[model samples]
Target: MQAQSLSYYEILHLPPPPHTTPTISEIRKAYHSALLEHHPDKSILTANDSSTPTVDEIVEAYNILSTSSLKVLYDQQLESVQQSKKIEEARFKRLIAQADSIDLDDFQTATSCVQHSKDIFAESSSITLSTGYARESCHGYPEDTCNLQQIWFRNCRCGKDDAYLVTESMLEHAFLESDNAQSDDRQILVQCSRCSTWIRVLFSLAE
Candidate 1:
């Protein structure tokens, strides 16, 4: 994923806003852990796992997050991006509804007009679980027997209850890349069915 598209908190594996800001100690711990896990040598050892983030990217994320002044600026930008997304989502839905009666050419034109808005929010926006961070077990089955996989719900800012549905496989995918389950928690992005807003589910995998 592009570094600009993700928050510094995510790069460091710490919870982002709408949740408590991590302490310096927590940030330091996460930075060291990320360095160990996503090290260039580690990537080489793993046969050049293309999915691994570059060391420079990790260091950049650390630099911004570790500095209080930069962190504030970063947080403001995140908020601005989120606000723009919500506005775009609302506008797009209205346009879609209105476009139903328009000709195909007109519909295409209308959509293209909002391309900039779409680009701004194209990446999955991250957020914590409404139920708070909870421990989950995998039940020895790859993804099938994770009993707690029952659809978890989160309310959306759109005033819809249970609009964000957390599914079984979503949990599995987050931890799939990990060589160690107990090392740290992982995040999976989900969207609000009603608002089309993306959410990052931060969760832990318990053996």
Candidate 2:
């Protein structure tokens, strides 16, 4: 099961603090509402042994928000979390701008291709271009489907080290623009044979 990401306020369906502070009574009300819906005894999810958070979680969230010391600490933590998100968003925008400046067709020369990938992908590792046939492996990036890593590299700058650059998406965009992708989202993943880091490669002219 996917990990939980919802904040305490979000789990309770109340406005985050500093915007609208939920009173102790409101917190209690929200807790009961969510508890009845997600409580283990009433929840069908318990039958399947699912990973959904339990009623204990609802009580915990309510206690944190309803208490003075705990609520202040949680609010501070939320502020830190929001600030991190904003930083990530700004970094993403910069990477998008960088990816836009790259020339995908630089594959004409090995050095040019290496330079392009480095500039656009922004990884410090050196490039080791793949010369052999495609390796038989997959990264399973898009949910369940295993996308074959197209370009096989022996010693190269491995996959994306920075979270800001959406290398997989950029590679797909570049690949579709450079070659015929046949309307398949499955073809978007690429990988490093040496480091085993997931990367993206273009489709071949042969198929």
Give the alpha carbon lDDT tens digit for every residue of 6-119 in model 1. Answer: 667777888988688888899989999988887876645633655545677778888888899999998898889889999989986665443212111211111111112222
How much is the lDDT of residue 205 in candidate 1?
Answer: 67
Question: Which 10 residues in a row give candidate 1 its minimum summed lDDT?
Answer: 106-115
Q: Quote the lDDT for 89 in model 1.
A: 91
Clashes of 1: 1
RMSD of 2: 9.8
Per-model TM-score, in order, reads 0.45, 0.55
Candidate 2 structure quality by residue, lDDT tens digits, 53-137: 5666667788888898999998999999899999989975665443322222323222112223433223324322332111211
Clashing pairs in 2: 128-156, 190-199
Q: Candidate 1: lDDT of 47?
A: 36
